[model samples]
Target: MRFARVRLAGALAALAVLSAGMTQATAAPAGKPPPPGSEMRNVALDTKPVQSSTYEGGTADRAVDGNVDGNWAGNSVSHTAQEEQPYWQTDLGKSQTLTKVAAWNRTDCCAERLTDFWVLVSDSPITARTLAEAKAQKGVTATKVAGTAGRTAEVPLHRKARYVRVQLEGTGYLALAEVQAFNDEVIASPSPAARKWVKDNPFGMFLHYNMSTYQDEQWADPNASPALFDPTDVDADQWAAAIKDAGMTFGVLTAKHHDGFALWDTAHSDHDIAASPYKDGKGDVIREYVDAMHAKHLKVGLYFSIWDRHNGDSVELIQNQLRELLTKYGQIDYLWFDGWGWQVPYSQVPYQPVRDMIRKVSPRTVVANNDHLGTLRTSDVIVYEVPVQGMPPETNARPTDASDTLDTNRTWFNTTATGAPRSASDITDNLARARAGNSLFLLNVGPDRTGRIPQDSVDRLKEIGSAS
Candidate 1:
């Protein structure tokens, strides 16, 4: 597991931004500090489930630390021999009032099985200690009534505990998904606020798996013949299940990479999975992906490259293709449109056309055209591709989150190839560094010649999960 240090240039720019905003206090809103002596220590204990937040219709792709080629359906699975702590912790720096504590899970309603939910609180920071130490801690757990999927548990003001932790125990079973915490007793947020939450999440998973695996390239040219596209095991459920296990908030799969190869059966495009060698050339990869992810109550992100390397489609033709993709897929949360070397001189013109098409198709969806062509181009979330090093300052034009750096606010995952190896210390430190910067680490475990994620990537991801 090899790793690269974050480039200094991006760090400096972030510092500059901090300096500009120095006058504003960066503390949490007014709240009473926890009582003295009863401080938060070893907070992430096994007695209570951690409150996690997850986006619906999302996907995850990876394997467990000790296991190989296995994908857990959801993240809430409990550990009997060893209990891994959740990724987050809270310190009662200052005791605040006691009104309401809301817990946010991956979804409001369960797709099938029911999971027991509770909030646990203790005056301690959950350290990376042994499970025995955590079990010894003094904490309180509250059982919560399950609500609809993607909704919050707005339980009334209960007794005030010095420390508060949200726990979700599977209904005597493994629960796959996320849980998040809310300070307010009541949960209320406008659309923009919700968008802020998504942006704040910063880190997410971008999965690039398809016939491209056989091609051994990112995406094939749209003009490339379908005869060249093929896959042996393309399991949508596995992809989503792996991602959820890795504790990723959401996933953006390459429904169609730059090659213009549509994973789903698209009537608008002759070049797609239906014309490929998988599932008798009759499967809708995107539909299967959407259904699989939605069943787990995860948020969905579709990646459609603007430049079709294979389709041989002209700029105008590609625009029409994108329109069809956007229109065909309903209830999408995020649309990832990359604008890198792919957008040369001629390819730039289709930007607005693509943006207009996305709005017409899914106006509610958040479109991130990081390179400056999409409608939300000026939007706060921009993806800066760190080719070899970290993100460059030039890439931080707007309030964009640096994609690979540790400093990005929301979810900036590491999408580097997985062939190489880095030291464990480097990987651990860099991920910690990223979390310190308020960015979530995204590990892109590229798949092999087959559709499965490479063993090396899966191994590295398990290392990360173990550390978390």
Candidate 2:
């Protein structure tokens, strides 16, 4: 949200470097003119870059290094040797609400290689390893530039994206001088579907209920006995009421965690509440939590861990559990996935297959995967662990939320009575900070051993609510 130039301070060095690439032609490249707008900043300058392939000494970084040297001999042009749909991509650091993309073609020779190139904007990181995989990822928008966009070409782009790719179809060779991306000083927003969760539900509660809660630790052993999970006095209504009274809009219950313990009576695995003594092994914690949240007219969220230590890289088992939750639970609004990309890479359990299943079962559900992916690369929103990551950014480029514990010691699960909860002033201050950054604040309130919110935490929540 701040307006400034991003064209790094090497303007003089860039000009000196570009001179070696130019030919006898004194005239500049020809292209369409830019439409009216605020001052433009080249976001592509010196940013992280990659391409389909590197030819000779031409790396992807040359194109975006603020050098428009058109000749290959100048070492400023990026030439991709691979033939199949060659492309160049850049990460703009964060999501950018963009306006236009200006691409400079090779001037000395091989200008034909830049013909019929496309400008693509994507929400996540792209895969150009295979032509089939590359073609399948049709981005948010793809603008085709005719061959006439010769020399200096300005392609109109009115959209938002984090990753921008410059691609050519049926590539014999893809060569480029420079690529500059401009923005009109507006931060890229999340999709309209996400407005409800990130914009409307700005204040939410994180219910850290799981085997970890019973075992009195952040993460309990995978082999922890299911019989130890007994919560004889568990009350979902109390949890829901306390959240509602605190003026929160949503709650994320831990349906299953890294230990492979399912809170519901999941048929996929017997390591669930059904195997426990709660309600004589007939308890469905998710069922009660969902019903209670819905009764109070609040959005529902479920936290499911992808890195199941007990299950051991079982993708099919993950899919079946997700299917059960989506189909059985009515209108679940959010899913917080943990230990996917950070703990376990996506190569083991591909992100697309799991994403496809979610799209089919519940298209509207917002997924906030807590895998420490800084941006909204593989998730619908960014999850900032307030304790671990400190605080959310001063300005968020995409939908974001900060999750922290109310316990003064910052324990996520109930290890002891929350006798010293965060003060109302401290909690409300963070809430205001997140709101100012246009993000949600998911403050955690862990329930104690008897399955009841600590009275001190409840009273503090009310105090914050009153202050608000």
Candidate 3:
């Protein structure tokens, strides 16, 4: 697939006001690094179980039985035949600064059945007997919990609650093998270093050049001939130069898109740059991009789409590719996952395994799923596509980035034709709005098919750079 690169030059000067923006959004204290002598302890084990509804022999108490082997099946058995909203909750005995909740799925089969759900927290006791009654309870703070293919789903809850509940929204069996909870003193935020990076460098550049650039399509057909993919003069140095001139702190390249074309040479797949005519099938775009960014003192990021049209969806395949990207590259500062709802729903995608792999391979790399799931409570960062007017409200809770096209027409890939780029004044205003809302503004500009950013676009970027 193709991506565009945009520069936000005045971000450094905007930080002073941006800091104030973060304060205006919320009075809550910023997340602090974990103190010494901190450890996670399961607080929900053996807690009293409360349920809105349950299937045959699947009682609420079974959820907290401490036996992960026993599955607690909810009301629905089939997708078409299911409860309006099945739910299960537990009494934490007392109010606590709830940090995280881990839910285990039945491993025998049909893990995809439990797709979308929510984790609700309440300070007061929940006396609701039915699913509808439980959902109607007031003063209950809830966070959406996306389903996963892995056996367990761990979600962080940076809120206070005495009663924790899991509510299912989809039309399918709402089953859980186990439910565990922990307080902040025990469990801490996963990536504090990554969060600091976002706060320090609020603006970045996105490079979208790939096989699709040759085809002039957003997503190239997988069956298309690999020989057609070729750039006349691909220079990572030129891209890095533009980024540094624009005052961006980091750059993310599309290493692999929905079409499953790898920009880097990979031994795993034939549908990669290694199969293309570029560099006589010996070139490695990712290696060059990373080196170029490092040479410019800019952090490196890679974009990979989980939905692959060329290679059929497989968790093993995705993890293998991720292992290569995380291990082969020196260090990936950011990992962006796009094409969420195209091939498979976000819940069905195996995020737990991927997350584990990222943590193991590159502990510092920040992970962002383009699903816009939630603010800080959701993914590492909330990514908005073509947010010209500005980002939506609730995005202020966590670090956020809004990406838009530099060309007013909103094209992602460069065309032979030229167009007027967004004016400097307009671009800066967009940055201001993003900053005020506590978000980084990522501007996109498609490089030409010859692997060269259009001269007009570069000129406009230079104007933005100097003006900022």
C-alpha TM-scores of all predictions: 0.50, 0.63, 0.60
After superposition, the stretches of candidate 2 with alpha carbons farther than 4 Å from their true spots are 1-189, 417-419
Query: What is the C-alpha lDDT profile of model 1 across 406-441, one tens digit per residue?
Result: 222211222232345344455556545455533334
lDDT of 2 by residue, 375-460 (tens): 33356787777765445644444677788888888877888544389889999999998887667999888887788888888898
Residue 305 miss distance in model 2 (angstroms): 0.6
Instruction: Give the better candidate number (1 or 3) by TM-score.
Output: 3
Give per-residue CA lDDT, model 3, range 111-208, as digits (tens). Answer: 77556777777898767655456667897776676655354566777778889888777556667766778775433232566457667776677777
Off by over 4 Å in 3: 1-191, 375-378, 387-395, 416-418
Each candidate's lDDT (Cα)?
Answer: 0.45, 0.75, 0.67
As a whole number from 0 to 100, the lDDT of residue 204 in candidate 2 is: 93
Clashing pairs in 3: 3-208, 5-444, 5-445, 6-443
**Candidate achieving higher TM-score, 2 or 3:** 2
For each of the candidates, the C-alpha root-mean-square deviation to the true structure, in angstroms, is 18.4, 16.8, 13.5
